[model samples]
Target chain A: MTAPSRHALVPFVSVDNMMKLVLHIGVERMMTELAAEIEADFLRWPLFDKTPRVASHSEVGVIELMPTSDGETYGFKYVNGHPSNMKKGLQTVTAFGLLADVATGYPLMLSEMTLLTALRTAATSAMAAKWLAPKGTRVMAMIGNGAQAEFQALAFKAVCGIAEVRLYDIDPAATAKCARNLAGRGLNVVSCNSAEQAMEGAQIVTTCTADKQYATILTDNMVGSGVHINAVGGDCPGKTELHRDILLRSGIFVEYPPQTRIEGEIQQLEADHPVTELWQVIAGQAEGRSDARQITLFDSVGFAIEDFSALRYVHSRLKDSGLYQNLDMIADPDDPRDLFGMLLRAGAAQAA
Target chain B: MTAPSRHALVPFVSVDNMMKLVLHIGVERMMTELAAEIEADFLRWPLFDKTPRVASHSEVGVIELMPTSDGETYGFKYVNGHPSNMKKGLQTVTAFGLLADVATGYPLMLSEMTLLTALRTAATSAMAAKWLAPKGTRVMAMIGNGAQAEFQALAFKAVCGIAEVRLYDIDPAATAKCARNLAGRGLNVVSCNSAEQAMEGAQIVTTCTADKQYATILTDNMVGSGVHINAVGGDCPGKTELHRDILLRSGIFVEYPPQTRIEGEIQQLEADHPVTELWQVIAGQAEGRSDARQITLFDSVGFAIEDFSALRYVHSRLKDSGLYQNLDMIADPDDPRDLFGMLLRAGAAQAA
Candidate 1:
């Protein structure tokens, strides 16, 4: 048999390179592209393996690994949520992920998912809104103006054609920061005092609050008919956004039913409470937005498939930009039996 | 609040750095120190939050994430198994792990576990033997000698006081390689023709095969009373070393029962069959061996706690040597709300 030829090792995109690539690509264009990719992946949703994220929760917050595959490529995101981190001047959440070849079980790429996560999450929201939100929705109510607020505003502008964003946060400075960041981005930005003011006359309501408990950011009275609610932050078991009454009244949609049952707004309802998986609606396998006057809820808990799509998109983008560092993570032994040889070579090099 | 002092970014030990550190420390010393750490951790096993590892199996092999936590410290290992990788001059398994603080969910250290795994596996095997193997059990029958053979031989010498190793592999070159690697390491290493020949006059038999299928390397007839079998390679579904009859005839011990049920030699037996948890035995809650003539089998599937202990031990060593590089993996925004500010700073630095 011919000796096995060594294939070039896979390139890894470090956090520094990822940030540089994002800056070069322009965050808005990247968000728009990421949203398109998420939508495209959502359209072929059945082709992917899906599972609720495996989460390890502590008394403070949670750490989760979300994994999914499409029979060819496997992807997983490592993320942590520590709401109290903000008190300590850390982002409430941070993430990173890997994309690997299923054929060889080799990690093909690793990217910073912290910034990418914000972009993909907004993109996912935009993808859902394309099907679930009312046509020609121009105004959005954004609750909890934090790290994710800017991306959400821009994604709404690019994907759903939202021209106005009414932002509200308990901390007024956070709302001001969101508005200042979005200045000159061609959006009518309004800083509101409360969720009620933000939701007034808005076509879409988005709640991305970071508290690790059940906080009713949008009450039943605040939500209007013909509004699509993008509930982003109420993701762990005890954390929730909308009041249970609002979920009971609205037509609910989720990325994965099993995960949403325990983590999304629907977690408050019984296990049997019916909700439509967003993929079914995106694939035209189920209905979305039955009536313009009826409230619709896309209970977004963040799924593995979105990360898969995001990683694929980032890998492609990095390739086009020629931006990424090759991480020497995998050992490429000359002889499979000679792992010790690599160590010897490395040791000799260090000694020299 | 004083702007959250930039989060102390976690230090990452790349594969190259890890290899250099291992070579600098010397493998035998590292293995000895790792064995001590594993023993210490095993003794305090009840202080951990343990669970069966999460595995994703494909036709080629399996990828697993093994996570465990003490009340204060948490760690997890990401490893992949592909037996055919050796044919491509790649290691059958490659792994990396992280140690984090439970209080902040901040990863404190990241290290390549590919080499560390071999060291720790051998250390763990020797640790188990020290407690369960008969006193003065110097002659060890190492069946299916492969990449892990040299480490196992060295660890047996340092930890279990074994002076000789009888090695046998399906391929004679593997045994020769192991023998060559162990030359002048103070062990009387012998290459044997078959598993039966290797076990001859040996008090301990260790099966460390790589096949991803159930193959009985040892039968009841091949084993004698007073022999300790360290079963290491039968570590996934459909992979096993000993015959079911051998387990029935021997006093079986396992790392974690739930994991071993699906991955170890006991996988072939009925679920309700009684077996002693190694930790319980180590904690003195259960018996290890009733008599010198009793047969003891350590059906190890490689638990996460062992990896946690290994990571902690290696991190400590790396710190003492000052050998690890700090990875810019986590974003350290000065004004927690100013992640965008980091981009501006990077841009400004570039301009400067």
Candidate 2:
């Protein structure tokens, strides 16, 4: 048996290191790799221990813990969403996650998943669209123009080969900021005043708005046939973006049925409403878009397996990266039964 | 409105810092404060959200997330237990926890909970004993001389005014270590070979043996009437310390019914077996010790609110103590909608 060392430190990746690592790999290239990782995990979806997130909801916001394991490694993310937090100069959501060894239950890596969640959500959305959206789609109508707008644009560009993004938000300043950020990024970025204007000549319609109520950002008249809709913002209960009539006419695909029934756009439908599992399509057991007139919709609610895939991808890249710090997180004693002895030694060391 | 600064930082207390803080406050004093905090929270138990822990069980061990909130602050502990880990020279249980602001969903503190959990578990045990044990209880028979043995002795001394501790274990070296650790800690410590010898002339009996099977550490004939039992180690399924006949004769008080029914000693009983919630006792709504000769048992499976109280106590002590370091764990953007802008700036700074 190998002797256990006195130092049982876990590697920690802070927001700064995460940003540096992403820039080092280039954002688009990172998104591509993350998409591939997510796709690979989705292909073997039955191997995972899947559960919908455990959420603690209050009047103002909700905090959730999403956990999953693949018999080898376990991962969980702690994330919170408060819409009014943006008015208080805080990001609407913040997150952190850890990956642990299944044998010992010791945390292996602790990472800031705020940025990684954005990446994984976008990667998941684009991956779904690759199997659902029309072929050779070059234009995406972005209806949110907020924190996730640029990521959604880049993910589709890198994963689904989109060359143009038409952006619009209720707030003109948000559209200006998005247009300024995506300038000279090799895509035709157009700013529009109305959601209908952004949808003009668009083959992929992405509605990602920020609200806690059931107000329609997309109406039935705005959605055209033969286009794929990536509905991003309506993730939690009582929060949806599309009208009920629009959902009735489209073929909806979901990440997980039980969760989507409670938190996704399909929450508007009956609990037993039929929706195709995206993994089934990716695994070649189900069909994607069948004809030119079919309207496909991806009710994009994030799941634990996607976060596991992102953490797995990060762990694979963390090897020899020199981009992390050691966190003295675990108490390691010489004799495992002598935890008191370990504390006493620390007291003595301080005295010396 | 106060100007919202573009900075979001979380305080982190490492294992070293936790030891320093504990020593600074004195372990017994910290235990006393933690007991007080736990008692205070238990008094208002109906106001908090209570749920059984979210657990992921594997062949070797189990990892669990215990979460609770008091409407203002949210706390959760990530803990693991594996009995065979000690043979591999690793702790059988290790943990960490986070406390976050409920309004904005921002993490406020992250602390290593391996040592803190030890403190809180002992504190909770002693606190429960104060209400159930016979008056003027001065001698405690600690029947498992393991890592938790010393803490249990000290907590009883600090909280219940115990004057002597009798230690016993199957392994003589464990008993020796417990005796050595408690030599100058103001209480008299005695090492014994067997449980019967340890329980002689003792008013309180604490069985905390670390085994994963339903082994009898305490028998029916050995546990005399009028003695309170603090059962701490039988915290998982298929793990029990006292004989079923002994449990049948005792009045059991548990943390949470749904949890204690599965993990505590009461798992051997029928699903609707009569057990009282300890919070009801603390709240003066239920009976603790009905008479001096009645056998009272506190079946503690360790609830989430106890961990919350411990974290609350530590967070209060952390103010201006310089025992914690700031971790840049949250993403703070000048414009909450401009997360992409923040990443672009980071890239520019790295290139510059």
Q: Rate the local accuracy (lDDT) of all candidates.
A: 0.83, 0.90
Q: After superposition, which runs of candidate 2 have C-alpha atoms over 4 Å from their true positions? A: A1-7, B1-6
TM-score of 1: 0.96
Which segments of model 1 are wrong by more than 4 Å? A1-10, A348-352, B1-8, B344-352
lDDT of 1 by residue, B72-148 (tens): 88888888898988886667888778887777777788777877888899999999999899998889999987878
Q: Candidate 2 residues B1-352, lDDT tens each? A: 1122335578889888888898788889988999999999999999998989999999999999999999999999999998888888788999999999999999989999989999999999999999999999999999998889888999999999999999999999999999998889999898887899999999899989888998999999998989999999938999999899988999999999999999999999999989999999998899989999999999988999999999988899788678998777787778989988888888887777
Candidate 2, residues A203-300, lDDT tens digits: the string is 99999988999989999999889989999993799999999999999999999898999999988998888899999999999988888788999999
Per-prediction tally of clashes? 0, 0
Q: What's model 2's TM-score?
A: 0.98
Error of 2 at B238 (Å): 1.4
The C-alpha interface RMSD of every prediction is: 4.1, 3.7
- Residue A79 CA displacement from its true place in model 2, Å: 0.5
Spell out the clash pairs found in candidate 2: none
Candidate 2 - chain A - TM:
0.98
